[model samples]
Target: MTPAPSLAELEADCWQQLATALEQKQNRTESHGFQTMTVATCTHLGADARTVVLRQVDADRKYVWFHTDARAEKVIQLEAFPNAVLLLWDPAQQIQLRLTIEPRLHTDDHVADDHWQKLWVGGRKQYLSAHTPGSVQPAPYPGFPPELGENLPSPEESEAGRPNFAVIECRVLAVDYLRLSRAGQTRARFEYEPNERFNWLAP
Candidate 1:
């Protein structure tokens, strides 16, 4: 990694990349490279990571959101230690963003409800699956409720998992953004602590 740019430049670049990534709904694919990040959580045993979708991002780019099953192991890990890392990479952009944050769970309230309401029927169907997340099954499982029966479940069925559904709110403490291009590679970092500052780095 080479020396990074001053904090101001880093921050500006981060904002630009983040905004651009969000604005483009389709860039040769359905999801933005930032949407699915490798969520790293600390457990008593060690660190664990899994890919999760990017549910929402604040205007300031300081906050990001993801949804998960309440029964998931990561939920338990977050409760123990809220600090986590979201690692995002875009093969198309040849860029990677590493966000270190403190995660807060949205249990029940307007925040969770609004996100739930925004979900499409197909998305809502995920919660209707009867099988518990991470549970052992005798046969191959698709991670959904058995016997979906011709139509999506009523609001009640979807709501059944509402309690089990959880939203992960990440308040970014730092973002390390790296970009690779033909015009040489560039890397930078922006930190929220010790005052907001951006620093350039060697690719």
Candidate 2:
């Protein structure tokens, strides 16, 4: 039988997986492991959960970044309550990671500008929506203008989205990792806030 991985090894492996996911291109299905994560935020009504694309991850700094329209409801929620949770699951690996984060918004700043410049026409197209996210439309809106349809905009044309593009920089306060197996399950927590804490948890 294969021996169980040590806590240290498991921790390293988890970060490696995240790093790999960040480097994967949009065409790579494996990227979904990290590309699509559930983000939970607090609002006046209650807790809101939504799936967001993971744009970047920094294991060393314990930070992650995602983009959104500045007018999105989640953006407002984050502004009111900067604390949020990011949940990522990889079915192939039978691994799950829950991240506690403090998000900072960057819209009309150099940080937003830098990220905007890196986005291709396809990536920028989503920001060109005429209506705010979650708004009621007269008939139906395909998020972006229907005229654009599947066609990618030119580099110059994509610039119109710059004003709507916003980046959320999440400072990871803690990470809870879990892996399942027929033999047994492994769980660990890594905290990096007021004081660093690391330990294995009962599975």
Candidate 3:
């Protein structure tokens, strides 16, 4: 058996997995569990949560980001309450990461521009929707023009979605990491906000 990793090694593993996901080095399903994440936001009535694709990660800054429509309900919720939780689970690893984060919206800035340039036509198609996200529709909507069903949009045509494209960047304040096992579950917390700290937690 291998020796148990030091606290620092465990933390580095977490960041490495995130970075690998951004690099797309692994197949989507086989990605180290961060290809997608669940974002929970506060609303007037209660809490709201939805799944979003993970777009980018910066281990140095401890930041991760994803894109959404400018008119998304979650965006509106984040505008009101910038604090949220991001949840990720890797079934293969039997591990979970719960991140407390402060989210910021970037609609028109170098950050947004850079991310926009990275998106391919297919990824940009949803932003071309005529209606806002979560809006009720008379009939089912493709989230884009009907004519473009199951078809990739042209680069020029996709450029029109730029105005609706928005990026949500999360400054992860703390990470609660858990690895489930029959022998024993391992858990730890890594905090970065008020001060950087790391410690094992009761699993």
Candidate 4:
């Protein structure tokens, strides 16, 4: 295997890539960008993966965040295994970010509450559904209760789901960045094995 980059180089490159990826709001809603990340987790039997939105990225801290319904099956999987991975590919930029992370679920913490408050009324509507996430019910259901008077529930009606809405904080342990370009492709990995130490991977 090729030698990893020096500690300083690894840290600099990882932060630079992350800052560029998250700073581009254009990618947030783009077809294939930060929003379209594959979240990999472990279940009782083995590993599992699914697409999830990327809610936040803190380059300085080398961490990322995402949201999920506490009732989702993935939450159960996460509870079983705190280790997870996030895979993001930006077709527009021909770049991919593979992040190995340690996840912590924020349910009732002040952090989760802050995120919930910022959610729009329409976005908050998602958690107001009658049935739990991934539930099998007779006939199809829209998830939310049929009636909400005329508008989305005030924070009170939505408050019940606050505990149900969870924010997943992913502390990045390592990140592998692969970019495909006309001038040959480039690949590199950054490893922060120690909570405080960082190392680089050869391209």
Candidate 5:
């Protein structure tokens, strides 16, 4: 029988999985693990959850990044609360990760500019909406200009979205990992702030 992995090993594996997911953009199954995550933020009413695409992952720095419209409700919520949770699930691997993060928003700054330069036209189009996010409309809006449908804008045209593009940098504080398997199950928590804390939890 294979010996169970140590807490440290399990923790390392968790980070490795995230790093792999970030780099494997062509592998849909692996990429989906990092490509989409549910972000939960606090609001006056309570918690708000939304699906967001993962833009970058820095395993060494223990940070994750996502792009959003600066004027979005979630951006406002993060500005007010700053602390949020990112939930990622990989159905193929039967692994789930809950990450606590301190969010820092970058807008109208060099950080945002740098990220904006890396965005392709398809990505830039998301911020090109004439209406702000969550605004009530008399008619349904396609999010972007109707003329741009199914066609990527030129580099110069895509620049129109720069003002609305914002990057949310998440400084990871803790990660709870759960893996389900027929052989057995594994659960662990890795905490980075206050001190490095790592432990295996009962599955």
Candidate 6:
């Protein structure tokens, strides 16, 4: 069997996996464990966590982003507390990544436009919601208008949702990587901001 990779090599592997996740998301083919991540944000009451699909990733810049409704509660929380934690687990590989990040919102901007333009009709359907997310309703809501049921909007129709689309871009400051194995577990920390530092940690 091959020997375990050194701390440096492990760090490189972590970044590579992040890049791969984005690629997989684009392909829309094979399933990827890293496709979704739990975003934890601070709220006045306490902490709020939600699962967001991994949207865009820039390994060189150490950033990842996902789309959301502009009216979503999480947007309010992130606006108040820009710092958040991104937790990703790859059940297939038994690896979990925790990233400390600084999030920036992009709406009515070039960044949001780019992502919205690239989004497919089915994905845009959610953005076409007539009501704000998490709003209490007299009856159950299907997110989008009932008329659009089981139907994908035309490209032109999809554009109407642009006003509600918002992108949350997260800049990764530090990464905590953990891998579970039958033999043993490996954990490490990689800090990119303030100063670059890497160290192995006890699992």
Query: Which candidate number would show the highest lDDT if scored against the true structure?
Result: 6
The CA-based lDDT of model 6 is what? 0.92
lDDT of each: 0.78, 0.89, 0.91, 0.77, 0.89, 0.92
Candidate 4 lDDT for residue 191: 74
Return the clash pairs for model 5, or none: none
TM-score of 5: 0.94
Model 4 scores worst on lDDT over the 10 consecutive residues at 23-32
What TM value does model 4 have? 0.80
TM-score (C-alpha, index-matched) for candidate 3: 0.96
> What tens digits encode model 3's per-residue C-alpha lDDT throughout 53-136?
888888889999988999999999999988999999988889899999999999999999999998989899999898888889
Q: List TM-scores for all candidates, in order.
A: 0.84, 0.94, 0.96, 0.80, 0.94, 0.97
Provide the lDDT at 90 for model 2: 89
Identify the superior model by TM-score, candidate 3 or candidate 5.
3
Instruction: For residues 98-154, write the lDDT of model 1, one tens digit per residue.
Output: 999989998688888888877766677777657778888999776667677566877
- Estimate candidate 5's alpha-carbon lDDT, on a 0 to 1 scale: 0.89
Best by TM-score, which number? 6
Q: Return whichever of 1 and 4 wins on TM-score.
A: 1
**Error of model 6, residue 82, in angstroms:** 1.2
| True-vs-predicted CA distance for residue 83, candidate 4, Å | 0.8
* Tens digits of per-residue lDDT for model 4, 1-203: 87746657755765665556555643544343666589999988889899987667787777888888888899889888888899988777787889999999898889898889877666777787767887888887776777774578776777766767899999999888777889667677677768554433445
Model 4 alpha-carbon drift over 4 Å, by segment? 1-32, 148-156, 195-203
Which sections of candidate 2 miss by over 4 Å? Answer: 26-32
Task: Give me candidate 6's TM-score against the actual structure.
Answer: 0.97
Q: Over 4 Å off in model 5, which ranges?
A: 26-30
